[model samples]
Target: MSLPRIAIDAMGGDEGVRVMVEGAALARRRHDQFQFLLVGDETQIKSALESHPNMRGASEILHCEDVVGGDEQPSKALRRAKTTSMGLAVNAVKQGKAGAAVSAGNTGALMAMSKIALRTMPGIDRPALAAVMPTLEDEDVIMLDLGANTEADARNLVQFAIMGAAYSRILLGRKPRVRLLNIGTEENKGFDRLRDAAADLQAAKGLDMQFDGYVESDKINRGEVDVVVTDGFSGNIALKAIEGTARFVTDLLRSAFTSSLRSKIGFLVSRPATELLKHHLDPNNHNGAVFLGLNGVVVKSHGSANAAGVANAVEVAARLLEDDITNRIAKDLAELGEARLRETNGGAASEGTGK
Candidate 1:
């Protein structure tokens, strides 16, 4: 079979075309079967490709003179969709010219363009931004609604759970342990939407998931659950808080290690262990944030990410395409529909009997 070509917004990231092109080259080395559609300025992209001989052979440049600004509003960005590098890359996926699109540009703009161009999949009212984060255990945890939508209702929350589980299956290769993020673990702790969504998930019969009820924010990184579902507003705040805390701890450790000569000596002795911890906590290692529930795959790479980060994001897009994630989501939705139908029928029968 032919390898799926990934559309890259070469002009997107803060590091400019050079970093994006280099990252694509690195990803090509990791995934030999992948091809690239490099969308950006022809002269700049060609010049950047000169530094990456291998990428030249695997990629074709699509000239796009315009770019979406980092601070541009989604509404204004939408108006420039035809000429912007990010827009063109996403359009390639919608046009079937590429299997997936990856951008390290404005998050809001990318989300807006992707939704407008590709639309959401059947049974998905809104697409959620899902990303994997390091945990205390050896594996990573998947969390969703990371600022895709500010608020979500019961149905939206339930859909996020299903979508998150499907992504977990692809990444973990099995049914994932899913949970709703809430203030408390008790059944009646959260608001009406949380309780309603929990009930729906509990009653869902055909979903390939293990719903583990509510999971408090404090336990998110404990590796207790494989997937955590929540509203975008909450999820975004939690994600940022986790990031900030990681930075704080690392900074404090650095300060402690260099406080005195004795501490410096100790740091040298523990350098290897510290290096491993640094690698584990590096944002570059977890650079991909996917917009799930879209008709086609779209990965949002961090705007300030380096080459390694961009490569990781590209790899994520390729994996989703290879795993046929969209189809898996559709199947899960079909199962949910069947379950709902059965429940309705059962309720009607009980009503008719009037016991």
Candidate 2:
């Protein structure tokens, strides 16, 4: 079956046209049924496509010379929604010209444009930024609200959990193991926001997820948790910390290996193991950061991502489109709505009895 065409902001990333077109070409090669609406400078896109004949045949160029800058403010970029490459790509999704949009542009700008263009899905108060992180297990872990909203109350956290669970189901193919990111796993450990969200999830029945209480930051990439939910403030901090630590380890290993001839020989002996570690930790391998809870799919690729990373982001958009992530989240929200209604009614009855 043919998949829906994905709109790519071909001029949004660091290397712009070249990397973007190459990435789309690589993705199309991987998923032969994939197609794209490549939005960018007409000349640059056409030139880049010459080397990737496969993409040339599968994509239609949407000429756009205006581009959202890496440092431009979201407010500033929002005004040019109709002319900018990133804005036009997102508009394609809103206009039904594309099933999803992918970009490596300014994230704040992308999020702002997408929210205004697509709006939040029904029952979602605010959309969350969700991304996968490398884990010890064969599968990766999904974490959300990385930097969307600085603060989220219990209601928002519950919504995030629901959205994250639906995303996990799509990506991981199982009833996800959900957890709140907290300082401690104990019930009384976190602030009211975390504890209250946990209570609601526990009290509500029939949620398609296993509410696994809480997980500490240390355990985020330990391969035990499936979905980690938290406010953007905390989530962003944890994400940066994890990224920094990974880099530190990689740099340390490189220096150690090159420090001496003995270490160099040892590195050669352990090259395979090190290569596996390098692959596992490469950000490009887990490149897509999805704006969940949107009416349509909008994936954010790392600005520095190379062709492989961009390809991963494109594939992510394709998967979400094929699986109908919005509908999946809608169904999960409906179930949660039923559960919340039951909880409210049960509470009302208890209050009336004065027991």
Candidate 3:
């Protein structure tokens, strides 16, 4: 049997090579059938490896002279930093040297580089990032497009729906209920693009997905939508706001716990529940985002993510690889295009006639 290989960006994040090496090592221990290739400055990577004897024989390093910083413009970096560590890791996926790529580098640069190297699949207008969000229910929800494409049309939203649905099915082991993110439940609401996308989604065929119509932001965690679709701009804002709110609430609770003797006693009594909540809200458990609609899997981890977080990202990549999500997504997207075209042309003659 062949082992799966993941390319790691050794020079990314604040923790750098130590976390990258540790993450790869941790993942390898669980599944000895997995291997990794760390891409970065060869000397720095080797020096990092020398500090850990356990990983000496487990991984290989690929030399790359440059590294793209987090603040660098993605478009400019794509042209100038072709040999950077992040670029090399993603390029390996395009070249078929690895099954998947995992990077904790600049999100914009990674997204741009992945698209440039791997290209989007046929019929996918623009790729988007879909991250797993913990829901009030026992499981997780998949949401997109986390700032990959800020401006989207009706067609783009429909494409996101198709891609997100396929991802839910492939990763979650069942078809998900799809919902368009909107301010209201009525079909007449939302921007013109969202309204049109709702219709397109409603009439869409061959997706084998359940469309539950428009769901408001409040319903995201209410088990009303398993897959929420929206433009990248709104989606990104929602993601950060939710994360920030979660942190704020946690901090408030910590302050309360340390306030007084009574509060400390109360905290001790609620410690178990608080700990469980922390586990559920930990970003490390769900650190990876898959750039859907691409030819291959490109998993992005938070740039400040630790070894555990990177390990979680690696697990996501491995699971997607095992699930063969891209093939199913492509099939669904192709069907959506055919359905949208038929609806448009079929309605063309009836418009403005009031018939």
Steric clash pairs (candidate 1): none
Q: How do the residues 37-76 of candidate 3 rate in per-residue lDDT, one tens digit apiece?
A: 8898888888877766666676778998788888999988
The lDDT per prediction is 0.95, 0.95, 0.85
List all candidate RMSDs to the true structure.
Answer: 1.0, 1.2, 2.9
Clashes of each: 0, 0, 0
> Any idea how many clashes model 1 has?
0
TM-score of each: 0.98, 0.98, 0.93
Candidate 1 lDDT over residue span 43-121, tens digit each? 9999998888888778888999999999999999999999999999999999999999999999999999999999999
lDDT of residue 256 for candidate 3? 96
Which consecutive 10 residues in model 2 have the weakest lDDT in total? 200-209
Worst 10 residues of 3 by lDDT: 51-60
List candidate 3 segments past 4 Å from native.
1-3, 50-56, 337-355
What candidate 1 gets wrong by more than 4 Å, as runs, is 353-355
